[model samples]
Target: MATEDDGVHTICPYCGVGCGLKLKPGEEDGDVSLQPWFDAPVNEGALCIKGGASPQVVNHEDRLTEPLIGDGDGEFRTATWDEALTLIVDELERLAETYGPGATGFFASSKVMNEENYLLQKLARRYGTNNVDNCTRMCHASTVYTLRQSLGAGAMTNSMADLEEHGEVFWVQGANPAEQHVIAHSNYFREATRDGATLIQVDPHANKTTRDADIHLQLEPGTDIPLLNVVLKTIINEELYDETFIEERTTGFDHLEATLEGFDMEEAAERCGVPLADIQEAARIYAEADNAAIFTGMGMSQHTCGVDNVQNEVNLALLTGNLGRPGTGVNPLRGQNNVQGTCDVGAMPNVLPGYLEVDDDEARESVEEVWGFDIPPEPGLTNVEVSNAIGDAIHGLYVMGENPVMSEPDALEVENRLNDLEFLVVQDIFMTETAEFADVVLPATSWAERGGTVTNTDRRVQRMRKVTDVPGNTRHDLEILCEVGTRLFGDGFDFDGPEDVFEELRDVCPIYHGMTYESIGYEGIQWPCYEEGDEGDQYLYQETFDTDDGLGVIRGVRHQDPKEVPDDEFPLVLTTARLEEHYNTGTMSTRSPTLRRKTPENFVDIHPADAEKRGIEDEDYVTLRSRRGEIVLEAHVTEDIKEGVVWTTPHFSDARANTLTNDVLDPLAKIPEYKAAAAEVEPV
Candidate 1:
């Protein structure tokens, strides 16, 4: 039914790697197939299992194809687009006028394109509310907040390509790229390892990524700060730190040194449950290398001390002079494809586009002048805070492409809060667990059926073209956003298409000023493209940092225990992880027949020692209970995890991991302590 010309060039919509993909029409009329783009700079013809199985979800039967309005009695009736939009406008206006703008909140999507996110945030601000946030609050809010505080920028300091080109050593912490970001692992990390770069993995579990590592320091859960502090002390005591770079390019080293003086290597080794020799060796390998990179993940950013953990990571990089150059810098592997772009476009509660604080009068006025609307000076609630504020400070909610009911910590509490909302709207491609609580559900097109730009983890901005038609009566996210915007705020939202929104975005967002769709040909350009015809910088801070003094700041960090520690009642530490076959919340991936067949249900990975202690055998049905709630899943006894720790994936709804995760928030980043929660397991 289609020819060669029908092939659409795009980027993978799964992870932050943002691998280039070629979408071709499949056997069916609207079906599509994915082909890896060899010429692409990021993936280089390599794709993970998730990327290969992406097409299976494009035509899934469960896709939401029509607007549905809930009848008070748990039934949904098909409604016209006009009917749904009118109801939404009326309810939003009623709530805003009755309870004031602060009573309503907007939750943007990290999966959607930059144009859509910009418009969604614009809609919130124009409606006289600053209550806007995204999924980043759940994943990398600490990384962004901490990096901006220490290095003056809140993004990956170096490119993925640099890992292979100039890297001599790699220090991976609290991440399993082999499962989460497979293409990046296969293409860059694997190549770096092959070329003699030493790979040191620091995690609570020995995973597939750690299998190939030169050394695996499998430490205790929630001991990131202590372990890293020991590494810093080793580098300092051995005189392996770059003194000249520290003196010239950084500040606050004196305070950092004072903090390190209090951390004893032997004590830290015992506290972290890792050998002192292993910690010293890993530190030596990193410090002695000519160039090294630090890669972190959600495992480091989802704790009560999340910001401190990232700050220490930054401290390690600054101390070793491993920044602002190829193969060297602090890099955080983002969880979502467009999460970096979503935050960049000002979906955050406290900032405008480009990380400009909303309280800053100049920045507020600049954005106000462009949109002809006064911006809110006060900051709003975060994702976790929004859930807590529902039924009290917040009443109405607008959620786009995010399923907080499944993804948020304490799943039962989130579900209860959603039900308590006076009014709720969910815009997504499928009927998600979160949508079940929505008063109205609007059908939205998937990534394969939409055209927009998404920024990758490496800050590369690439265009995603529409590969096929919308499945049914579903509308593009931009169309839904614009209709809502125009109806709510008179004429500011009248735009031709996504390009018009992007053009307007370029005018306001300094980081995206010089980029155009034409310039971003098949392979997209990285950000900080300040002018036309300028090739974006591959790595940042090569000459000067983005700080006021053009110097990296070393923030003094102290180690702290997790909010909830294991005790006699709950003797094991429970941690959440990802499965290679599934994506976050399992909305799209679980719907795919191929991925579902590969991983049909969730399982708790228990250490053999723990399993034996509990009389739990492999494949045994087990009940895992935490302080908040409990979940029942099959047991997977393995030595991959540590003795006192157990791991599980949060992909299946029947055995929802979030139900048992802790909701304790990090004081700074407001991220839930999803990494380390106290729990007890029993064989059923």
Candidate 2:
């Protein structure tokens, strides 16, 4: 058993909050428990249920203990590391030689550390393919795309501390932080609300978050743009916008003003299902506050018009001059723990590390010099695009810690496309739904068994120390990737440890240049730390925006209906939500006995009116069918949801919620419409 001196400090691997946790060895071997770290800046000694239970899954019996190679007949047998690596390298080589580098795609993990992600992307790029992406493609790709276009950066403009310290007003839209980011909500957001901040919540349901909101604008599903536009019109008409700030620090005012001409408040209220008075009051509360911030999530970015939704939010912030200051900026609460870091280190198809464009010759040359190799000049396919080009264009895939079958929209289509791949390799701790289709399943170390760093939503890079030895024959992600890269490309994959890979990453990613593990110390450092002895910037854009002219751009956006709308056959709209007790796909969280006892199964939440119409009662089994697929889940009759809408969480494997979600992609972001889908329900 570990003593007090044996405690190891690390960051939580669940959500983007990145709460600090201390692990002490439990009474049993390979078992550890989470202890609160009071000095952590983000959570300040607090942890959510998921974070507290994170250690429960580390030593679970179901963990993949060794590498498995699948035969042509759907049977998998244990294999040595040599056999598995050789098979992977040989298959990758065959695919590349047969169909060129572009035919292979690499899906990185957002759950791992920044160093691991950087190495994964480097390996993929060095192998001569830019078809690399991550789970962020489905979560916040729209937010990144829109924010970068308007403000010249794709990350959160302000720190979480800014909201608690300087925020006078909080506008939360399309997110339930109370359930999703429990520590952040309990420690910072709830504290802000208690401190007399005006909290305005805009969503389609009345849940735990809405209960705490000062004003709830429960609008119609997929009508965020109309309601937001009306608010912008109200602000402009009342002359509440920052005219001086706009004139001096922003551009495109005329174009934005022109787009608001035909936005009738009454029409918007009718379409959005919000009262005109409520809309006007929300606008005044946001515009009149001395300092206000807007927080959005997948609810705003998982639609056909996701980019437009984010662009409108950016315009709102720009018009009010709410950016470039503490407690006043566009903040997107990222879903995964290291999504911000994964993107920052260039796991996407378009950019190299530090948001450098892959197509740019100078950027390509900069990375090429550091790695001593030629890099790909062309931009690659996104996650959704790779799935769409499975059988014909793309043939092989290497997925790390992502369960596309349970997370991606149109589950049946994704499963079929994955099955059609010429060669598939999955590296994860558990035998997930996606792993069932893998030709080679490589066992990987869990968070407690690995030591590395993960960047949180606040852009804070914190270290996660290994608390236990790897179970059985499992290997760390860095070791596996370096070995595979060395075998495939023959050189430049040499690395002593995670810190060595991070040093190489710092050389390529300018944002993380001066940040070292030792420098991070107990309290982590936010990014944009350039030189030694320089502390990182807490909130970005203090003096000027990152744009070419140092001015923010305001883009006018219009409301667009979701790709799949309710019709005669499918009369209700289905949306997805998350459970506080469970994380995405239930890969790790479900293994916890405490979590499972709290939330054992998934259920479709239907309004009392809808449930009554279908003769369905609470706990009654029901069949929910969409054009794509169908599933059976228990019906939860509640008045919290709108009458025509239904909600469910995707954490349960037995009742997969993604089966009924839409796969229509946004033109710019390429994200699926996961929040809105046409469906119908019947009593089972």
Model 2 weakest lDDT span, ten residues long: 1-10
Cα TM-score per model: 0.98, 0.99
Query: In angstroms, what RMSD does candidate 2 have relative to the true structure?
Result: 1.6
Candidate 2 lDDT score at position 450? 85
Instruction: Give the per-residue lDDT of model 2 (tens digit) for 85-143.
Output: 99999999999899998999999989988888898899889989899999999899999
Off by over 4 Å in 2: 1-6, 27-29
**Local distance difference test, each candidate:** 0.90, 0.90
Worst 10 residues of 1 by lDDT: 1-10
Model 2: per-residue Cα lDDT at residue 608: 93
What tens-digit string does per-residue lDDT give for candidate 1 at 205-286? 8888987799999999988998998988888888999998899999988988899876788988999999999999999999
What's the true lDDT of residue 423 in model 1?
91
